[model samples]
Target: MIRVAVFNFKMLPTRAFDRFSLQIAISGMSNQTDDEEVHVGPDGTFRPTPQQAEDLQLQLDEVEQELHQAAKYGLYLVEKNEELWQTIERLHVEHETAQTEWKGEMKTVERHLYAAQQERDAWRLCVIPLSLRIPLSSRKCHAVEDEVFQLQQSLTAAAAAQITMQMHRRGSELRRSPSSDFVGSRSVILQSPPSLDIDLDVLKQAVDDKDAQLRQALAREVDKDAYIKRLQQTKRDTLDIIQQMKTAAAMDVDVRRSMEARHAALVDRLSAVQMKLDESQDALQTRLEEESRLRDRIEDLQAELRSQGDDVDAQTSAIQSMRHKCARLEKELQAVSELAEAASTSATATDAFDRLESFFNLTALGIILEHQHRIAQEQLLEGSSRQTIARWFREAVASEVPYHAWHAWLTQRITGKPRRRFFAKGADVSPSSSLAKAIADFFDKYRHDKKSPKRSLESANPTPPYS
Candidate 1:
């Protein structure tokens, strides 16, 4: 028993259980402790192997720490449930009270409902007339209409901005082109005729003068300003087109929606009218049946009167009833006529749509061209300042022409690519021949440009040789 207690001591908690187990072992008694955290007794306690018992106690301690947190969360949820239950009970009590009140008012409500039913029947019989009717429109239409209007406004503003930018760019370009008083720069100086063959001293003076112009141009940043103006204009145009597209987009989604709403309202009106007509027809049918039965009764009464010697009171009452029946039938027929007209009109109005604008408003070439121009400026190129001219030339041309090829044609020269690349097998190609051909083509193009400059911003009219 002492050895058994020593082995069981491993299951102790807080090291204190181990001490108690040691005492029990020495005393030769197996007794449990009073602590609630751990109960070593046989009842409500699991006995484990000594190794298992030690592991279980360690796990329990870790779980107890976690339980502290879980208890708080559980308590919070439990409190919430209690509050919710209380609220539900309160609402249930209020509902019971309302039900009692409703029960008390039921008689009055039934009286009103009966009155309405009689009134509706009278309308069917043409005794009471229906004047006011609901129109086919939705509350949501107002909300969406405002948003579409705003989008249209924004698109219009964007287009205007683009137009302003274009005007400014043209103005600046006009100013820069062919200004006799304008000074030259290193860039222009380098491009000047290579035949100058001036001695180094004379060339140096021209270089200095050109350098001064370059400095002035740089400080003033005319190129940069022009570039900025062009870019802004392009962006404005794009944004405007996008705005117009947005309006179109809004209109597209709304077109169906507005129509649907109108359709729904019209359908509702149509349904209401149909219901009214059905009611009137049903009443009319009933009246006709009654009149037929009355006619049969009158015929039978007349036959009886002829057989009887005296029946004046009965005859008088029968005649009055027959007249009332005829009058009721006439009223029903009128009601039926009115209801049929209303139904036909409703069907005609609900089933059709009317156009508000001329056909093909969006497909106009001018709008498409402006739209394409704006998109190209904003998305394709960046910060060239020559964006208008550059983008137009680039996209308008055929894709088969390479960019370098165009540039080579423009400059009347090619570098970084020597003519030797093109060859007859085992034979050397002459650079002079390639150069000569290029020069001839350049003159030809120049002559064509002089005849008339095409109104394309992108196509360069190489300046005509001064006559």
Candidate 2:
């Protein structure tokens, strides 16, 4: 009841006459001894005693002074509230500006992080393949060296065999002509022993055959020398390639190290930026909470002021708008955070793909290197043999035969089969005439003459026929 009466008192108009009348009525009612005692005049007006009227006037004066003081205080509160609202607006604007700047910085950091990841991935991809390739190149070199060594051994055996055959022919001649000096000037005009009855024409022909055999052997020796030189050159080339591969590997390692250092720096920078972003976000959250609380306080003050019949509806609507704005800003911040996270994840995936690409590139490089090495080895092996064959054809086969025909004939001889055609399609040689058989027969006669003791004797007994 007292609370209701105080509310009614505050709701009353600040009028001196009205307050005085209310006081008089209250005093008259309190002074009544019984409920039946009359407190009102016949004219329906409250009649008070002189003391009650003076006391009511004094009470009226006090109430008017209190009302004036309350008005001044309310006005001061209104001014302070306006200043507070201005401060809140400034703080909200600053918060929004800071949030915008933070988001920009986050985006920049994310881009940097992504670039760093790509570089790091590239480094990893390049390094692993280079690391594996070094050993493979070394192995290829070793294999090439082994193959060259084998070729050299075969060439050496061929040379030794040729030397032995020459020595055997010389020894056989010495045995057949017991009195002739093998290397003296008199041996140039050889004479037959008394027991041998050889015809002059037969001996001369035999001597010509032996000379041809010796020439053929010398030609073979020359071919061997050339073949050895070619092998040596191939070996040198392979060594140079190996050295280059080593240099490339070393360079790759250095590049990888540099990239790693750069990546580490970027990671540190990214981490620092992330930390700062987190701190900014946390500070923003705290500020938002504080702002929310301030808004609540303002809303409470506005409610109180509204209850007191103050016009604060416009201010309340502005505060609500600010709340909506703050909520929107928070959502934007969350979206930015999600974007940063997605960027980070995408960067990670990009790095993985880069690594995979590097792996594939390395694998491709390795395959290419293997293919090149194989081709080089084949070329090295075939080059010397082809050169040797070419030299043999040039020296042994008369220049009358075209190189293609000689090559075909040689191939047929070595393979022990007839060729489709030894000469070009339009050649004058009949199809029935086997060029391969002809070459084989010539080589057989040449070999037989080289081995025959009669030929050796005729060659060693190099004297002019008995005239």
Candidate 3:
């Protein structure tokens, strides 16, 4: 039995059973079966004693316990492997989700970056023209200011000459009929040159009055010049900011766009203001010319009055005509004054009809409307057939369409709807109806006529019935 147990131990897998434990079991079995060796033959075949059998059984039980312990350990390993595999699968799923989220986030970032780039490009484009226009506009404004200054100087000179002439007339009248108070006071000194003393006093008073008036006019002109200079300076500062933005490499799109819009608005306002100034200058020039003509006529009449001193009827008629001319000039001056006041009071009212009462009186409105209609007709006729122009003008007037609306209609008729740039709004220079009306009025009143080449529009055109 001991030999059989040893043989079984040898036959057991070395990898599954401990060699040391197996040796011990075999040795113990051998010790028990030592006495049983008497049954052994020389060929090694033998039977065991009862004690040897018990020892063999005990070794078998010990081997079985070790085998059961190894199987339990293997089962524990298999369960741990299954847990590891589950963990790996869960980690893989998490990694895939993370990758998908990263891709989506990247796409969103790319889309936003593309939009920002496009907006930046649009602002850069808008800024380029504004930068270029600033210096040119400033130069033009300076030139206009120079012209206005020259016109003012000439007006002052003319006024001075007129005052001198008036003084001369007053002196002559004083010499012809001295004041009773002067005669009574200087009766004794009247022996040699009675009129000389009175003439001196009258001339002195006239000169002082004229000088005061001239000073006041000059002061007003200076104030106006200063105001204009201030406006120009502000405009220059705005342009400088725009230029700086243009030079910069990058800027916020919303800020750039707002600045661009503000610049455009400023340009439009400046242009309108320039137009008003030009019109005002022209009106001033016309008034000066008319004053010159009137002065010459007055001088001629004075000479005639001296020569025909006894012809009261002709002199009265001449005086009446002069009075009428003076009244007309005064009316024109009042109109000019009103226009200037309107312009100075508000920068927003660059277009006509913004303040209807400020621009057009009850008497002037109809004639202004007629003149506007004529201008519209002329403009239309220049490009299209006369029949079409006439028809359109007539229809516009009949419908009581505002000038801006009519201009838009005419523009649409001539050209298709105005094209806009990518990411840009409508055309910048589209004329307003009120602006058209204002422009027509300005031209009608100030533009020189083809006929009577030497005459101004105010002189060449027939006076309106209301006037």
Candidate 4:
């Protein structure tokens, strides 16, 4: 709420006036409506609300809180009676003054709006040439029509020229009519202008030259016949020389001389070889006794093998009769094999990943360790492939690594057919380092250290279930 500091308290209704006080009391005791409601009239003047009333819809509770806050700053001045009449008249005068001032501002805005509208109209007019296209279609049609008319004119001109030419040709043809008497025509042709007389000296010379050429032609034929015989003689001499050279080259004695030393050496070696062969026969005779004894043992073994074969046959028969049982067993074995293989593969992949991790870590550790290898030392410091210390990855290959079977398995995994050339592929991957290390580790772990081991691959125990 706002009020003038030097309020005209003299204009206020009498404070002690019991009649007005009673009226305020009566309203306060009764309905006791808002002061604005009670004082509102054409002649009344009221103070503004303490808070600036914003247009936003806030909760009543927040509005009240705001109002309470606003009330703390100042209180509204209340009044009644003719004093409000004078204030109301003054407010009306002020409102008129504000309206007049606003009208002036609105006129300025209107001036700007009118200018802007004019500018917009000018811009639209300027853009008319762009958006409001005068279609090329009508102009194009006119141009095409003109072109066609011009072409027709050209055609007419060309036809006229042709007809004129034809008329001239027809007139000439009529003048050149060949329907004349023969003697008269001959006489006219002979008596024509001197221009018709062509020179005959060149023709007379040409006839004499032809007669001379006929004589020369006879002489040339005789010369050609003689030359052909001489050419045949020369050709025969050339062929004779070529044949003699070929015969001499075929009987070349140099090749025999080249083999002479080798043939002598062969003769000497043959005698020595014969003596050695005699000694070899003697040794073979002694070995034959040993072989005979071995043959007896082999016979006994063959007998045993035959017995075993019979047993095996019986077993085979039994297995054949129990076809379903064998099939089930085989399937179970196959399933077990597949499961084992899958597990092995998973374990291998895991182990490989683990090894790779460990390998990198160990590599890092080794970098921290003393430097012995050149590559490793370089790789450690550099971090970059050029700078980073690296040894062959195979250096840390485990002794327990399996090579052959794993190679076979890997081959099976990579290619549907089992490739025995994995060693070659491995060689290609890292021949000097990883390949050697892997091969070493695989051999040490999977193969028996003995010279020989009598165990089939399938019979061997499975790898443990760990990476």
For model 4 the TM-score comes to 0.14
Tens digits of per-residue lDDT, candidate 3, 299-342, equal 44345434544545633543344344445544655564456455
Q: List the candidates ranked by lDDT, beginning with the highest.
A: 3, 2, 1, 4
Q: Residue by residue across 429-467, what tens digits does model 4's lDDT show?
A: 311133224333533433342122222222233332223
Q: Of 2 and 3, which scores higher on lDDT?
A: 3
Clash pairs (backbone) in predicted model 2? 188-462, 189-462, 189-463, 190-461, 190-462, 190-463
**Collision count for each candidate, in order:** 1, 6, 2, 7
- For model 4, what is the alpha-carbon lDDT of residue 335? 48
Residue 31, candidate 2: how far off, in angstroms?
A: 4.0
Q: Write the per-residue lDDT of candidate 1 for residues 151-193, one digit (tens) a residue.
A: 5565556555655675566557557767653344334544533
Ranking by TM-score: 2, 3, 1, 4
* Top of the candidates by TM-score: 2
Q: Per-residue CA lDDT of candidate 2, range 1-467, in tens? A: 00002334466555745745554455446434553333476878655656655665686678679888998999999999999999999999999999999999999999999999998885565445434654665565566555555655665565557556756666776777657565652343244223123333444455556556556655665665576566557668978999999999999999999999999999999999999778756644543454344345434433443453332453354334334433443444445434444553323323222222222222222222222222344332332232333443333223344322443443343333344442344334422123223333433443353353432322222221111
Error of 1 at 240 (Å): 2.5
**Over 4 Å off, model 4:** 1-208, 253-467
Of 1 and 2, the candidate ahead on TM-score is 2
